[model samples]
Target: MKRFAIGDIHGGLKALKQVLERAKVTTQDQLIFLGDYVDGWSDSAAVISFLIELSKTHNCIFIRGNHDDLVHHWLKTDEQNENWLKHGGQSSKDAYAKLTLSEVEEHKKFFSNLENYYIDPENNLFVHAGFANMHGPQNEYEPYMVYWDRTLWETALALDENLKPEDLLYPKRFKLFHEIFIGHTPVTRINQTKPVNAANIWNVDTGAAFKGPLTMLNIDTKEIIQSEPVHQLYPNESGRN
Candidate 1:
């Protein structure tokens, strides 16, 4: 089966659909989202709903990004703070504002079910930010560590469950894996046209919210398929504002 790891959606539902269509991802393919499903665009609620459905049909692994973390907090606390509002959580809240109590609960359930990180059988891992190794010799951390730090990555991978560096970042016992996939740091952004690509890590956030493109990688082939942004039409003004 072909597995795919996608970058942050950030409320870009249209882009997500277009990319999925272009990739021809069926029920057969395994889809892993790298987090930040809400924030940049205008469809946070829509995107979440789509993801819940997708998860049922395909092997979907949803890793929580920093932005998603905020959303979860907002849902539980019901406090509409600035941090939550500016980072796509507000869009999600607005989307659900009109729903019935039952419907709202359903949405809460979906958000509650999301995972923080995932480790594939191949020893490959997917995370939002990155992991921090806490106790082991390697002090192996989680995926959240990756989103924010690169230097400590070596140290985190140094330890395992027992808190000891197994002598291998990824234990040789698990077999060799090619790469670790992540998102959060954009490769390119609307503000900065120049991209910061991660050579060792695959940064898939192609800056869709900045109107770049929705990118997905075919893990087996390392091929990136993307959907160009759908431009919004504006009214032509002969003299009107």
Candidate 2:
């Protein structure tokens, strides 16, 4: 069975469906989603509902994103954060408004159960964003940093291309895992629209929330599959653009 790492979806269910179909994913395949499943696009609630069902049929590992956390907070307390709404939460709020109370509660439970990070038997670490601790995410002082931190990716990017893992200057945290896969900061920020590898970190977030496509990467083979650019699929919407 193949293991695939999916990038942030950002409510682009059409893009999500297209990539999965194009990749021909099977129930036997292990799908590790890197989060930000909701927000940006128009199908926030639908995306969550779809993922909840997908998990039942597939070996799926869901990681919590900062946006997902914010939505959960709003769902539980009915207090919407203004900042969250400004980003992509407004779309989520609008989409969720169509759901019944029971449905909302079910979605809230799904959000509550999401993991902050996942480690495979082969020592590959999957997280929504980066972790700060040299000892890895398990030892992170601020738990939320796992969903919000950019330092780990930045540190990896800043490292010299020729720097070997055994070099004294190599960051200690990179040594803890065979490889790290993350989503949050888009690779589009660097003007690339595909998964990028820096040191041992693989960034799969290809800006599906903006102009790029939804991406899925085979962790073992390093093969990539993507949907059409999100904006083209949802021509009427501006998804976090």
Candidate 3:
């Protein structure tokens, strides 16, 4: 069976479809979505709908991103704060334009309850953001903070060698995994530029929602398949402008 690792989607249904089609994913294949399912683009509704449908037909696992948390907070609390709304939440608003309050609540509950992260039997892990260097697999709450915190990323990349991967036991060490599949940073290289211990982590958030590339990594084979940024493919798009 083929295992596919997908990057932060950020509501780019087109890019997601393009990559999946290009990869020729079949029922025999498995998929891991790194999140950022909403915000940035005007197609959040379409993308979420696609995800729900795809979940039925494929071996799919979805992890919650920071943006997903914000959207859920708004729906559950009836407060779309400036922080979340400004960070590309307008697109999600547009997507939820006609949704009744009940519908919003339903959607909100869905995202809010999404799993924080996933660890395969292989000990390979998948998360929207990388793990916290200081707290990994410690308290169950650790995954929540790690997946939503940006500061953790910098800290992990700068941890003291003694307290880092080699010195830790099991998955608590961010670098204990043979490979960590992540998406948060938007970059040209999927595996990120840095090398951490024996593990190689990738930042697959190819920035699709920002008119950047959409990337996918075949976990078992480590093959990268990418699709052109949809926005850049069409220079004359009016709404996308």
Candidate 4:
């Protein structure tokens, strides 16, 4: 069976559907979603519903994103930080307004049960974001680290251009995984519209929360599939600025 790693969806349900169809994902395939399934677009609730249905038929692994954490907190306490609202959390709140109480509960359960990170048998690590102060894959790290750490990617990018993979001294987290996949920080931040590979880390967050497209990478073959630009999918509104 093939393994596919999808980047942050950010409520772009249309883009998500397109990428999955383009990849021709089957029941036997393992689908790993890096995180940020909600917020940004107008269909956060719908996206969660789709994921719930998808999980019933496919081997799906969902990693909790910072946005997901924020939503969970809001669901439990009805409190949201200003930054969360500014960065598309308002849209998520609006999306959930349409769901029934039971549906909302189901969505809550789905988000609450999300994994912070996942490690495959091949030692590939999948997380919403990189870890900080990591000793190994098994070592416990802060939850925020899984959703906010950018130092790992930054260090890899700062390496000398002439340094070869074999000659590199990887950080503890990198050494623990054959390859690491992450999605919290969009690759667009570096002015790229596609997945960016730095050292052994592959970042697939193609900025679907704004102007870029959704991306899905076939982990085993390194085949990349992307949807049409996300803005086009939701012409009626500006998706989270």
Find the candidate with the highest TM-score and give its number: 2
Model 3 misplacement above 4 A = 100-106, 133-135, 138-143, 155-172, 188-199, 233-241
lDDT, residue 150, model 3: 58
How accurate locally, in lDDT, is each candidate?
Answer: 0.64, 0.95, 0.70, 0.89
Clashes of 4: 0
List TM-score per model, in order: 0.76, 0.99, 0.81, 0.95
Cα TM-score of candidate 1: 0.76
Give the lDDT ranking, best first.
2, 4, 3, 1
Q: What tens digits encode model 3's per-residue C-alpha lDDT throughout 150-223?
A: 54345545555455454644235555566677777666333432212223565667666665767888888778
| Candidate 2 lowest-lDDT run of ten | 157-166
**Clash-forming residue pairs, model 4:** none
**What TM-score does structure 2 among the candidates reach?**
0.99
Stretches off by above 4 angstroms in model 4 are: 164-170
lDDT of 1: 0.64
lDDT of 4 by residue, 1-241 (tens): 9899999998999999999999999999999999999889998889999999999999999998888889888987899789899999999999988989999899889988999899999989999888876675346455677787788888777876676556645455567688999998888888988999987899999999988999999998899999998999999979977
- Judged by TM-score relative to the true structure, which candidate is superior, 2 or 3? 2
